[model samples]
Target chain A: MSPEKVQGGLEPSETVAIVGASLAGGACITRLRELGFTGRIQAIDCDPFAPYDRPPLSKRFLAQNTEIETPRWWSPDCEVIRARAVAFDAQRRALRLRDTSGAERNISADAVVIATGAQPRRLPIEPDGVFALRTAGDALALRHAVDAGAKHVAVIGAGVLGTEIASSLRQQDLQVSMVDAASLPLVRLLGRGMGARAIDWMKEWNVDLHLGVRIESIRCDHGVCAVTLGSGVAIESDLIISAVGARPAVDWLINSGLAIRDGVLCDASGSALSMGHNVVPRVYVAGDVASVECPNGSFARDESWTGAKQQGVKVAETMYYGAQQTVQPEPPYFWTEQFGRRVQILGRVSENGAVSCVKSVPDRNGGLFKVAESGAHVAWIAINAPSLFAQVKAGLLP
Target chain B: MKVALDAKRCQGHARCAAFAPETFVFDDEGFSRVREGFENVKPELQEKVRRACTNCPEGAITISG
Candidate 1:
């Protein structure tokens, strides 16, 4: 039987402190209001310009310097505060916040949603012409470098971000050379075959690839940048972009007693867990910062945009209706645009799953390949096949 | 209820259609557009339409009654 609901679900007058006002935090606020929550909401975030779309940062925004629009749901009712979360007091349901002026304050709430998200992992070497894209500011800075006539760009890391940046740079007619320690692009994330396909596509787009090598040094002298590989191969460029992935922004929660492995550990219902693995009541986690419990008892962070939004909604539901009524998560999905093609990944794509079929959509000039196991669709990868993807995804996901 | 989609803001995530196909449709290039008749939404479709609005990653959809 389903466990009893927490006696006295959240009242309309209760206050909820959401620490992070980006995609996940914004979504949580939207859902709370949709559920008729009239409570006081404190949307805390370090970014003065929070709640903006992030996917375009490396794509259209970096290439054409497109405007990163703020979410429509970011209304005045949420009471957004421009502050960085410094610490959490789980027992008291309180938070310590530091604003831009270094002023510190504490606020207690009936519930707290930790959605601090993640930050780009910086490289060991620091140089003037090097950059990493994560926020709107980062993208603008990178675009400024491009506009200032930085022709050749050396991208370090062949993961999704790296490849996407390379594609965007190529769209702007800038020469791009990519380096990754892995043998192919997205090797760890998408497996070997998909990685090979990505590398091939990048090559087709005229992006120089230096794979299966370690970076010995990245030096920027005066104006020119140089990247030296472990294989004695060296690449010269005017700029360097380190797309080395990101880590959860969980430093502030270190002393909060929350479980912190790769991210803040949370139960299936989005309730955060203490280091001893006990649920911390009224304390929740969402977005890239939440490492939610899985079937095998392992905690994993859903870092994708869709996953983050879903978690945000779930967290809101749990906060309003109580954890007993929290909905199970939907399938994982993410999309990317590169080399004039839109690629979408639905569900899980594993190399172990056999490739069931590859079909082409003649009308859209697109194609999709499916991965299945035991007559069930494990995942589907679609390239410029949104309609087909929609049908398959609709049928597969609830 | 009326739903409006900012064409400039829609990056073709196609989530609106996925959530409420009756209220939203996609263009040839996969960008989302509010279904023509959806300007005045039927009472029964309001919940789903609002769901689509809330779930949109780009927050391109807005609803007014």
Candidate 2:
């Protein structure tokens, strides 16, 4: 690659400011350098610690928080600001931040990257005992609750995150009950046939799964937490996990005025869309904050760990390195582990219709599964049969 | 003919694509995609491909007419 893009002699060419030094932002910075973005590369985070992993936070870390205190950090040379990006000025190509010390700093950049990951969405009732798992602090807090003899843990939401959290709670020897609004667990991701199989696996683990139901509120009853479902049913528990889903962390970008859609609206190249009227220069976005529209006319707002990492790296390469490669929205891919069953899906599932399992072979607590033609297979989901998913992944002709 | 996944109408059913991997791919959020060789999915594979589309729960995948 070309020599790292440099700005000045003593000072670099142009300062690069990355908001949210977590997964996407950090990946971009490192990749920018790899793609020869040698100018002063900077990354900012509100947390005192540097950037780390997320999958583990929900899986291994939750089970053994005592062993892994926080997600691992980056190399010593990579720049990190233990601060929060508070605002973006697309006009001036600058960013406003409040560091860990409570001091605000204004940093200007030739370009900006918004990778302000997501936060655990909470319910309004102020559930006295329920919590959501997203950040390191959240994981640590949940660990404390589990160790403190919290019995009858009720995890709300039956998606991957909620399932793993409940399974971990059960591993801690706490009775776990999983609640979701879907007819079967993972109905949205794995389809009905595979979903039933997943429920069967959870059953083996003895999880009290309340499928097709949602918990309306979490309140304490006689010193223990009572989770109330919409059906006027209360499930007694010492812990409750609220994991519906995560929204874009765009509170800071409210007035940034760069065309915010479900996530940040981005071009095929991951460049931020502009209404620049000459006052603002072009800005680009990737990761969770970016929703990329492929040249093929398809679009995706990907938020998985793999999606963010690869997209971040690609954005850096295309913009800085002269690859000039346009990003295509690939099919969705994510995996979840619950009660010894590894469920992975390669494609989308429609909400408006039916799901018929194409082929079935007995495998895990469930078996290998492929979610049929939802809308995209380049993005498909597979569980315990990546070998079969591999056939589809290669675009292999039948 | 172009390929498209009508995401709004999708439900995860792996029918149209599974039998004919050469013709379709059912991925993320119940979205189906037209495979490469867009020019030619062998006549033998057409039945499997069409069957997948017919069995699709949401009828989301539609190849250009």
lDDT string, candidate 2, A171-262, tens digits: 77789988777878766666665566677778888999898886677786544787788999988877677888888787888788776767
- Please report how far candidate 1 places residue A305 from its true position, in Å: 0.8
Work out the TM-score per prediction: 0.92, 0.75
Candidate 1 RMSD to the real structure: 2.9
Task: For model 2 chain A, give the 10-residue run with minimal summed lDDT.
Answer: A1-10
Worst 10 residues of 1 chain A by lDDT: A1-10
Task: Please give the RMSD to the true structure for each candidate, in Å.
Answer: 2.9, 12.0
On TM-score, the leading prediction is: 1
Error of 1 at A164 (Å): 1.0
TM-score, prediction 1: 0.92
TM-scores of chain A, one for each prediction? 0.93, 0.85
Residue-level lDDT tens digits of model 1 in A235-265? 9999888998899999999899888999999
Q: Please state the error at residue A287 of candidate 1 in Å.
A: 0.4
